[model samples]
Target: MALQSLQITALTAMRARDVSRPSREQQEAADRRPLRDETPRRDQPHRGRDR
Candidate 1:
């Protein structure tokens, strides 16, 4: 039936959408990770502090 086919198509689309989306845990883990510029800072001269 047309309605059944439409339902199946919708379900398939939903499944595909879910598969493409990251899980909440993955998102949280990403949030906890270090940023791109994150690096160990060594004692360095600061021009502002020199003022």
Candidate 2:
């Protein structure tokens, strides 16, 4: 049927998108890259007296 064919086409397109999505390795590689706009900030120690 025409409707069935249309559904199959839509499903195939969706599957293609899912397959092209980045894998865990690609995501890790991207995360390791530094962003151009910011620098890492150091955490400051507490100044108040504490035993």
TM-score of 2: 0.44
> What lDDT tens digits, residue by residue, belong to model 1 across residues 1-51?
776665557889999999999899999999899887895777999878887
Could you tell me every candidate's TM-score relative to the true structure?
Answer: 0.41, 0.44
Question: Weakest 10 consecutive residues, lDDT, candidate 2?
Answer: 42-51
- Candidate 1 segments exceeding 4 Å error: 1-8, 34-51
User: Candidate 2 lDDT, tens digit per residue, 9-46?
Assistant: 78899999999999999999989988866668668766
Separate clash counts for every candidate: 0, 0
Backbone clashes in model 1, listed as residue pairs: none
Report the Cα RMSD per candidate: 10.6, 10.7
Q: What value of lDDT does candidate 1 attain over all alpha carbons? A: 0.85
Q: Stretches of candidate 2 above 4 Å error? A: 1-8, 36-51
Which residue pairs in model 2 clash with each other? Answer: none
